[model samples]
Structure formats: C-alpha cells, structure tokens
Target: MSENEHMLAVRSRINDLAAKAKTPEGLTEAEKAERADLRQEFLANFREGMRSQIEMLQVIDKDGKEVTPEKVKQIQRDKGLRDD
Candidate 1:
C-alpha cells in the first residue's frame, strides 16, 4: 500500500485496539503488545514526516536574509532543495 494508506491502516488498527482495551473483556496480552508496537511505528512515522518538513524549510528575515539554521540548510542542500 502507499504511505498514506498504510498509515491509515495502522491508525485504524490502533483505534480498534484502544476500543478493545476499554471494553469489559479488555485486550489480550498479544493485543496490548500489538498496540504498543503500532504506537511506536506511528510515532516514528510522525517524526520522520516532521523531519522532512524541517529539512525542506527556509527561514527568511524581513530584510531578505536567509536565516535558516546551518544544520537545516545542510540537510536541504543534501536533499537538493538548496543550491548551497
């Protein structure tokens, strides 16, 4: 599946597990483990998406100076989003 589709599936499963945990029967140990793993995967994906956004960022001052951080600029350069 595409990234968006996969993320939606993961989110659906996580919500399902959460609902199961709230019920009287509650979740089995395996379900709990699966929920934990899914949460981690979700978090990892979120962080990577945020990182990509940051890497593509460019900060410009009102005076027209490029004020982006050196590290971020380097990342953007490496990704071919910047000339230097």
Candidate 2:
C-alpha cells in the first residue's frame, strides 16, 4: 500500500483500539500489541511525511541568500531530493 493508505489504515486501527478500551475491560494482550504496532507505524509515517516537507523547504534571508541548513543540504544532495 501507499504511504497514505498505510497511514489511514494505521489511524483507523488505533482509533478502533481506543474505542474498544472504553469498555468495562480494556483490550486483550494481543489487541494491545496490535495497537502498539499500529501506533508505531502511524508515528513512523508521520515522521517520514514531516521529513519530506522539511526537505522540500528553502530558507531565504532578507538579502535573498539561501540559508537552508547544511545537514539538510547534504541530505538533499545525497538523496537527490531537490532539483537545484
């Protein structure tokens, strides 16, 4: 599945688990493990999406100087994330 699809699935599962835990008794061990795994997947997807947005960003000073961070530049260069 695409990242978006996977993320949606993860979110749905996490929500389901949360609703289940509102009952008299909480989730079973296996359900708890699944919830944890889904939460991890959701976080991983969130971080990757945030990283992509940051990578696509360019910081310019009042002098029109490109001030993007050195590490970000290197990451872009290494990964060919940008065209310029």
Candidate 3:
C-alpha cells in the first residue's frame, strides 16, 4: 500500500490497541510490544513530515530580511532548498 494507506492502518491499529489496554482484560505482552513499535513508527513519520515543512519554510520581516532560524536555514541549505 501507499504511505497514506500505511499510516492510516498504523493509526487504526494503535487506536485499537489503546482501547484494549484501557479495558479490564488489558493487553498481552505481544500486543503491548506491537503497540510500542507502532507508536515509534507513527512518531518517526510525524517527525519527518514536520522536518519537511520546516525545511520548506521562509520567513520575511517587514524590512524584507529573511528571518528563518539558523538551524532550519542550515537544513534547507543542506537539502539545496535555499541558497546562503
């Protein structure tokens, strides 16, 4: 499946596991392990998306000075998304 489909599946599984955990029966060790792995996968995807947005960012003040943060600027520069 595609990335979106995969993410949706992961999210659905995470929710299901969470609901199970709240019940009196709770989760088995394997289910708990699966939930942890799925959570990590979800977070990794989220961080990459945030990083992509940050890399594409451009900030300009009223004086027309580019005010993007140095760390983000360096990321953009390294990715060849910006010059200087």
Candidate 4:
C-alpha cells in the first residue's frame, strides 16, 4: 500500500479503537490507557491537519488577517459550523 493508504488504515483502526473504548463493555484499564494514548496521537495529527488547511486558506485569503485557532473557532461559531 501507499503511504497515504497506510496512514488511512491506521486512522481507521484508531477510530475503531476509540469507538470500542466508548462502549459500556469497554476496554480493560491497560487497554483504556492505550486507547487514550492513541486518541491523543490522533488528535495531534488531526490538529496538525487542520493547521495546515488553515495555513493554506490564510495564503489563499491573503487579506492581512491573522488566522489563529480562536479566529477559526469564532468563524465556525458565527457560521454555525461543526467539525464532522
């Protein structure tokens, strides 16, 4: 598989693990810890992806406006947007 495909597979697996963790018959303590760590890793990856997209948008917009996370959140709130 390509690198992108591998990354997608890993992300899918992480999502599956997260869903499992959320169940009432959830993971054991060690499994839960592992899931939490994986979730954090996924979150970091997701945040980085969002930052990159925001940077691209800032370049495209190029209106001398700062694009911080707060700004993004405010825009989302104003526009009634939610992350899928």
Candidate 5:
C-alpha cells in the first residue's frame, strides 16, 4: 500500500482499539492481548515517525552542530529544565 493508505489503516485500527478500551466492560484476556499488540504496532510506527522527523531536522540544521540525545539532555539540565 501507499504511505497515505498505510497511515490511514494504522490510524483506523488505533481508533477502533481505543474505543474498545474505553468500554465499561473493559478488556478480556484476548482483548487485552489484542490491545497490547495494537500498542506495540502504534509505538513502532511512532518511533519510525520520530526517526523521520529527526532526519528532516538534521537536514534543516545542517549548518549547526549535530545534537545527540545525551547532549540534549545535558543542555536541558544545564538550563534547569526537568530532565525526567
């Protein structure tokens, strides 16, 4: 499938799973398993999206110093921002 179609399918599945989770009956063992699977899928997609965003940002900031996670956290700490 194309990227748009794939993203739409993922979003639709996420919405369906969220609706199931919100019901008062709650999730059964099987539904809980399905929810875990959906959560994993969503996390994987989110991580991939973040990586793409980082790549795009790197391209945009080509003239700037490359910032690693460790460095960013250190900078946040130095600025008195919450690291946790």
Candidate 6:
C-alpha cells in the first residue's frame, strides 16, 4: 500500500483503540495486542518519514551559509546523503 494509505490505517486503528480506552469495558486482550502492534508500526513509519525529510534538509544561516546542525550533518555523512 501507499504511504498515505498505510498512515490512514494506522491512524484508524489508533483512534479505535483510544475509543475503547474511554469505555468502562476497556480493550480486550486481542485489542490490547493489536494496539501495541499498531503503535510500534506507527512509530516506525513516523521515524522513517522524519529521517527521509531530514536527509533532504540543508539549514542556512542569516549570512547565507549552510548552518545545518552537527547531528543532522553527521547523519547525512553516515548515510552518504551529503559529501560535506
């Protein structure tokens, strides 16, 4: 599935779990398991998306210099996303 579709599915499951949490009955064991799995998948997707976006970033200074943070620069360098 596409990223948008995957994200929608994850969000839907999360919302479902949230609603279950508000009820006096609460989530069943199966629902709790599903929630944990969905949460992990969602976090993995979020981290990957953030990493991709950050990889393409180039921070500029007021003086028109490349002032990207050292941490990000190190990631880029390690990933071979940038030579500098």
Highest-lDDT candidate: 3
Candidate structures ordered by lDDT, highest first:
3, 1, 6, 2, 5, 4
Q: Candidate 3 regions off by >4 Å? A: none
Q: What are the per-residue Cα lDDT tens digits for candidate 3 across 1-84?
A: 999999999999999999999999999999999999999999999999998887899999999998998998998888888767
Best by TM-score: 1
lDDT of 1 by residue, 1-84 (tens): 999999999999999999989999999999999999999999999999999888888899999998999999888788888887
User: Model 3, poorest ten-residue lDDT window?
Assistant: 75-84
- Each model's lDDT: 0.94, 0.88, 0.95, 0.68, 0.68, 0.91
Clashing residue pairs, candidate 3? none
Residue lDDT tens for model 2, 1-84: 996787788898899899999988889999999999888888888899899988878899999999999888888988887667
Give stretches of model 2 more than 4 Å off.
81-84
Per-residue lDDT of candidate 4, residues 31-80 (tens digit) = 76777776777678788888757643422237876544666666655656
In candidate 6, stretches whose alpha carbon ends up further than 4 angstroms from where it belongs are 74-80
Give candidate 6's whole-model lDDT. 0.91
Candidate 5 lDDT (Cα, 0 to 1) = 0.68
Q: Total clashing residue pairs per candidate?
A: 0, 0, 0, 0, 0, 0
TM-score of 2: 0.81
Clashing pairs in 6: none
Give model 1's clash tally.
Answer: 0
